[model samples]
Target chain A: MLKINGKPADAAGLTVAEYLARENFDARKVAVEINEEIVPKKNFAEVVLRDGDIVEIIGLMGGG
Target chain B: MVTLEDKFTLGGHEFTSRFILGSGKYSMRLIEAAVRDAGAQIITLAVRRANTREHENIIDYIPKGVTLLPNTSGARNASEAVRIARLARELGCGNFVKIEIMRDSKYLLPDNSETVKATEILAKENFIVLPYMYPDLNIARDLVNAGAAAVMPLASPIGSNRGLATRDFIQILIDEIDLPIIVDAGIGRPSQACEVMEMGAAAVMANTALATAGDLPLMAAAFRQAIEAGRKAYLSGLGRVLSRGAAASDPLTGFLHD
Candidate 1:
């Protein structure tokens, strides 16, 4: 199981791009990080998610 | 008469508008109108977990030509703030990050020491770091030494709309700190914004003042005017106040009876 955004997920061996596509997240608007390391946009397709990975997908929001 | 330029520079970028608007606590549709009415060149944003269910993004509502200042709102420490800043930069916007490290949930006060640490790290990475801090002279100086482009001292608690509760301390930072002192948070009314600007604050950032208003765009415009007026007053040199006695504007000898 992978922890994506602090929630346990069953996704394993799925690339970041594939996970994003499966989740309906627009790739252009969001930034992905695995285990506290930023996964650059250019390498999204190559970076695969493994079991026990902690993933955090972030985006711009309204705030002060 | 020699005319000096009336603009403030932050991280080598010159901005003529002294009002910095916060894009929070309101509908995204109103952002464009508020930005236009506020005449803000720089606007603040937050980085958070992207929701796939929500189709709308805040970046979409921001008009063209305005600089984005992504803030680390949820971070509770220096490293957490740094990580958030890095992720925010990867989102394809510019490298401007507002360092807001808060450990407390209720008051939402910034952790000044952690903020300074984050500023140092971010600035070294070439990010334009603007650290929001408690109104303290020592920490402000430390931030300047830590490579912050500008210092943002809060007037009161975040989103409280309490006005300038830290007036005198903010004044101390404005007087001592070399970097631009941008007053942030808890400015409820246009008069409060004007008061800080008159005290020589480089700029003012507000959100709740407009977000809670019945008319956000109109309130934004009011803040813009007040900020400009205060800047002008600062530039023109405000009239001195008498300590004990009142001084009449009209001369005593000018009266017909005299």
Candidate 2:
């Protein structure tokens, strides 16, 4: 599968677990919104990757 | 007339100050200095799922002798909020949970429906749920029914610094809701925090106003003095918004000249 993180799409056949294992995303502090709605935390590693899906993850900043 | 040493009590916690400080945004030294200078006993910190070292590492700054208040500021729904609250209990550091359900990012508006749901679940778990809600009287009442320790209504959108933007709604909350009402957000300055306290809010939480200052300690001390002044003013009870009554130096209209 082809995937894009933040910007460019790259050739990716890695499972969700493998990808997350490879990446350094603050999984506990980050919330992923796919196509505008949120993805459940439990499914972060279960859902396989696909091409052209917009995924945005937000984390807590050091503010009020 | 009320006195200066009056204590503010809610959910069985008694705090001497009318201000609540946030444990986010500032450095440990800054936070420590400001908190100590401000005499803030109640502090609000957020709980997130990420490992402490990776995300906002606020746990290290939990000051001694101050009550730790954990808020679910990032949780999108009731379930996530509940899970966070439970984790706090398991950690055995803080049983008090501050619930904030922000479904949107642009306005950071409170999702009243999901907040109520989370409050109910967390409260049932015997957690002292202090929910951050919109300044809605109806929802405040609902949260009280759900066993919330207190109701924290935003005076304005989070981090707006607009200052008491929901004054009228807040007054309504004070009138109708039995729970202690704490103005939680959009307070950008010491004066703003004071004004909210003077309006009879049990407490106010300030973050940006303190963290963004050129000198965080001085700003925090200013807020401390302001909060005390406001609390005192609230206790003394202002006679009217605007009314000038002159004291009798000799006599008023003695001869009725007019």
Candidate 3:
């Protein structure tokens, strides 16, 4: 069982989409960069995860 | 090519690449592609009142993880630049600013006196100012003296693709000035940027030329390679220029040549 911000995700290995849904986040409004490469917005649903992977999520705010 | 291995810092953010790109042209896809190809850590954005009204169409263009450097491009003076900088801080979440204060549409040369005056005030307010200036070396020194974080001297004129027109003065500014010398404007080609870097400039900023290119992504990649090559050359100390035709490796006239 992999931890989700210190808590384990539900049962099976969760895709980033499933993880975001479970964690109450709108994944589209933010960007996900795992390790270094920025995951394309379209890949969010297809990107499966493993245990102990470090994910950095950055949210974008309104700007000029 | 430059081999100086030069790096510049803005608001504590360090950047190794000497070529900075503007966020004004091409499609969102091209902008994204060019940024990746350019290897630019700093992506400059300007405020437009129209964007606020059309928020949805504009918001999608921003790239992920890029250090959003909001520029005061529309500001007519230092006072306006300061206000715009403050507002951009709220929007960009950063205090770094690119100050452009030319009022006239033709000849986008900055109002040097006002810029120096404004830089002093902005410095007091803790703003990291990078003012775009004319080819004037004295004005460049004055801006630096007035607490400008960095001074950008135009290579020719904004939006004009004449290339590095201020080479001689740019060299002097870079050699004599303590602060970083960033060459801006009039860079029509990547080779020109390489030339600027080779001349000991800390960095170069290009927009119109890249944006107007038929293949902006390709141009950006070319610029990226050129900047790295130039920086490497500068770091290793570029060989001096030879004006006359003929190799004079040894003493040309013994004591007379000396």
Top of the candidates by DockQ: 1
Model 2 regions lying over 4 Å from their true place: A1-63, B1-5, B49-57, B241-258
lDDT of 2 by residue, B68-95 (tens): 7777777788987776666555444357
Per-model TM-score (chain A alone): 0.97, 0.67, 0.69
- Candidate 3 CA-lDDT value: 0.72
Better candidate number, 1 or 2, judged by TM-score: 1
lDDT string, candidate 1, A1-64, tens digits = 9999889987799999999999999999999999989999999999989998999999998998
| Candidate ordering by lDDT (highest first) | 1, 2, 3
Q: Per-prediction DockQ scores?
A: 0.92, 0.12, 0.03
Candidate 2 docking band: incorrect
lDDT of 2 at B174: 78
Report the TM-score of chain B alone for all candidates: 0.96, 0.89, 0.87
In candidate 3, stretches whose alpha carbon ends up further than 4 angstroms from where it belongs are: A1-64, B1-6, B50-60, B241-245, B248-258
